[model samples]
Target: MLRALCALLGLTSAAIAAKFELSPKKFLTLPLGDIKPAGWLHDQLQVQTDGLAGHMHEFYDLVSKSDWIGGDSYYSYLEEAGSYWFNAMVPNGVLMNNSIINEKTQEFLEYVLENQDATGWLGPEVDTEKPRCLWGRYPFFFGAIQMVEYKPELTARVVDALHKFVKLANRMLRNGEGVDKWAATRWEDFVLTLQWLHDFHPRGEEELLVDTMVRLKWSGVPWEEVFSEEYFPTGPVENLTNPFGLELSWHGVNMAEGFKALPATYRFTHNQSDIDAANLSWDLMFKYHGRPSGAYAADEMLAGLEAVRGTELCLVVEAMFSGSYLYQVIGDLKYADRVERMTYNALPATLTANMWGRQYLQQQNQVAAQNMSPNPFPEDGPYSNVFGLEPNYPCCTVNFPQGWPKFITNAFLVTSDKKGLVQLYLGPFEVQTTLNEDNLVKVSVETFYPFGDNLNITITATKSYMHYIRVPSWIVGGSMTVNDGEKTGLVPDEVTGLLSVTIGKGLTKIALHYPAKIVIEERPHGSIAVHRGPLNYAFDIPRSEKIIAQDPREPHAVDLQMGPIGAWEYALDADPATMSFHNEAENDDHYKLPSPIFDSGKPSVSIAVSACSIEWPLAGDMFVTSPPENPECLGDVKTIQLVPFGATKLRISEFPVFAHSEPSLRVGNSYQIGDDSEPVQKPFNPTKPN
Candidate 1:
């Protein structure tokens, strides 16, 4: 069955592309508990489940009362705002409900029901009352997916409501004779809706699914109106239009790789044209320019290969959702792997480690995280968020929470029994399923991963059925072994880059191979980096040490080599290594910041850091953004040892890799940190002249 998943995807290289049956008692619903924020995900959604619920409610209630909803409403902003609330609140309310928060979510849901239109579309929010399909439709579709899980009967209504909304837009695009220019995008919300409807609808014909795909153009975003661009490139980057502005045309706009929709629509219907369209779209978006972050657009504009400038907060979340869905739609493990990798690194890296904060816009190569501006809104402290999230456009602020809550659902799902294909890793969640006609299986996971590196899955079965545990691509030592039978553990399948674990009935133990130490390596994109295993190791920076990250003062920058190997044995071979460090040099620039933000009047830069002595982990963004001093930086002779980026939140990430002018002559190790002596160098040469 796992092989079939990979082969099924091979049917249409172009088209990429879940849920539950309504029979037995605990069929489609997900399990819940004091779910630890495990995997690379948890940290983002924790705020919604814990602290941010109140503020979110206030924000939702505040928006619900505004002229935000109307027959001719400017819904892009409202939908974005509502989506921000629904994505976090809806799933959290259903899976990890708190009484106080539930009341707010119910109110939001009721408001939508009250405003339903006769056509079955609820989008009275557009100006001129013209119901466009894609943009505003997604947040509502996502909210409905959550609602259906909460209230089963609402499933039909949710489907009908979205069907009405999408059908209306489809009519304008395909059947409407004089509806001006219509919008039908593959990447838009409607495809997400269609994918949902196809997978879970109680009783729906395949024709509707076929119809959705039949009308789309394989061309790029249709650039007939609204979006002003000069070139219609493959990917959606800002200013990627032609000189005269007419080219690969997509859903009436440029950089709109609406191509992702066709194969997705065809996933259920198998329309080759639609599949062809989706593949073409995928080729275009990536061929032009894509980032390692899985986000290509620059500030909602499509700019290709502009390394220093790329990806928005909204794009990161949206792309993750799309990629995960595509993985499910195609039953391809690789797609799931892509989704997992991007979320683990790019998504979290986009926002602050804590969910409460985020950047309005992030530059891919803006290495220094320093803030030069004062707080725009008094209530929001300087370091609380990124630049300029004022009166509106708080997209990242509201939308960021959507990542993890939705991600938990994608973390694991049911696969076929015959094929040993556990397409995902980090599972062992409670999956209430029937093996024979009578027996049930409840799998519980217990392990402190990427940390402790051991797993114990206790599978309690009602009857007898086979379960496959996904084998990760990166196994440090050897493959996993299952107690079920001879070599029950999964071996790697070259066809589908995933390991499998197939076990039969009753309680079973599956041992997955994991390494104790994890080191992150660099990829070609030249943005932020990632580690193969769990530990996201950065250059160690000691908090108590006076060493700071960057020097914004003298245009100082740092760079490094990529794909450098040998981290595994690096620590083991350390010969009683003695290292030195210093106190984090406070930035005077930060002192110039407003109240509660200014520093303690310390210097803008520090000399060096102790490799492992990070005392103040709380001093996040503060230490790294502190600018260094001039070349006379330490006068005659000052030498300090530097640590890893992960070692200190206040330490630097973006550095001037290449030191120009031959280091301007060697400055001695006079500038000391901690209690260390002069530095020592152990050089290795393949052809050493001893």
Candidate 2:
């Protein structure tokens, strides 16, 4: 393959002399478009906006005007909710650009600017006037740094405030001041803020700020003391923890928050001290925090060392956003890899399938919640989990926006030589770097990712620049061709490889090979699971809604294939039609039955899918699943297609051992499942003792 200059998307060398400018933001022209994953974020934003419509303006007014203690708790709730929307939106959301929801952000900005003191502090209810003022600027900076299209002046204001706060805080700390005797821990926040100031200001006041932050020394707080782990983070929490005893002090995701801010410490000032401090903390965090979902743990109470506790909604959103930030600054595929896993498995697992809502917390085993709230809320908000506004806590209520759609920022970033680089592999369209240098390069990349084999990169070359594309570390025997002339084959490895293309000089035609791959990794103790791309599929289960009428034999175990995706094709083994449905009596412990207490201790088996929808008349449809035949003993059920654990609405991810190995039932080719030959059965009783 020789070097040849080809036309860039139909543009010739003569007209390709567009001036390229450097962007202070990650990718220069990111003003227009929505976030990534596209499944939940788009709908959630639209619905969340609608949900806030009735109280949106009022909510902003409440935050701006409410006095801390003189008013009712509603004001505090309003402040909390406003804080959530403010946090979730700016970095990424419907208001990142010129949208209706942006008005709320403007209102917040107005409030901040109007309330600034002569000393440059802007916070409410301050007793000692600590550096708490810095917390308010995150919203502004998050927006100004990302959206190059809107609010440039606002961005400058954000930068100005950042410097002001850092300088003021340095003086305060020097004079021995800043939030005396606080219940919650908020140490690295100062580290992060100083880092941000360092990064934002080109003139290099970051050194002094970083030094000041390092001296603050609030890093050693124990895990249990914090008032809210959701806001005032403490301790090391990870998914890879052993669930045995009263291990209250271990949490990986909680620790990962600190790790997340580590690299940011370095990127701000390019200094080794800040970087080293961050790395030492991050290295320890990753050791305890890494999880099976490709994320570090922190579901709820820190289940340390192994995934004792499950993941929480707040951790999921935060972990994903943190991973995205990690990807952008460090350029590590592993971070992006973790982000994709959390996005697909842990993330979707947190929310309901219809996008109406998500859970406050999620457990891997998720034993039947002796008393779970089915319709937790009155259905006021789209994903509103609480009775109306606030749920288990304000964490997920405000943090949900960061989970799905905000992934767009993590999709693409610029390389050292002014080229485009793809971070995570899950995708649909080809993403261009839009920047020739720092400014808009006026380019669009065209390709369908994650769906099929080929990916095309068509760049409208403004000038000859270096373009680097990530060849996914997961792709097996992947091959790529440039301009349909030169072709190169790639070897699969644990890490990604860069494929470089020079624009205008033979960058016209493009094709990249995505090998269909299956990943098999051994679990900690025993057993192995398989993954295809980002999806980890398990054995196909047969379902039936008819069984809801009958009783379930057992609840602890479930029937699934020996492996993740069934290796052999057996059609008749599982039937969705045999599932049943029944209303359990209030306080009725055992699987609710129409008749008297059963001799056997078991649950009535209804299709898991039906378990989610039957609770609501909102689901209007007749063909839920087909009915079972004489299923009194086997548990009567109506049948329908049952998605694997990963796909089901109310699913069990980690099932017990007995169900995995079905001695009587085995999959075979040409055998149709859900037919009369093979009966599909599962235990659903939530240990309701008669």
| Number of the top lDDT candidate | 1
Q: What Cα-based lDDT does every candidate model obtain? A: 0.41, 0.40
lDDT of 1 at 265: 45
Report the C-alpha lDDT of model 1 over 1-690, residue by residue, as the tens digit: 222332433433222232211111101223223122332223234444553333544443324445345444333333456655665667666545466666766776667766777765564444554544445446766776777766786766667766676666565545532121223233344555665665567255344443453333321133222222233354442334444343323221223324334445455435455434443444445445444333454444554544334355666666666656554544444445545544554555554332333454443333333332443212223332232222124555566666666666655555533222232546324344443465555666654332234566666665455555544444434445567445333355543445544456566776665532122222222222223332222332222311123223221111111111111000110111222222232222223212111111211211231121111111233222211211112122223333322122222232211112221112131111111342221111101100
Give lDDT: candidate 2, residue 489. 73
Clashes of 2: 73
- Candidate 2 per-residue lDDT over residues 1-690, each given as its tens digit: 000111311223332122211112332223424223232233334444444221334443333334322123322422244544555555444433435456655665566555556676644444332334233344344544443334565666666765665667666665665533221133454555555455445355644654454444332233222222232323332333423232332333344444454454344334444434443443444444444445444545454323224456766776676666655655545556556666756665554333334455554423222123332122112222211123355445455665544565556556544455443445543343345454333334443233234566565555566565665544445677877576787533233344566657323656777653333332322222234444433323222211111113222111111111211111111222222222233233332222111111111221221111121111111111111212122222222322223343333332112112232322221111133352221111001100
The numbered model that scores best in TM-score is 1
Lowest summed lDDT window (length 10), candidate 1: 567-576
TM-scores, in order shown?
A: 0.63, 0.62
Residues forming the 10-long window of minimal summed lDDT in candidate 2: 681-690
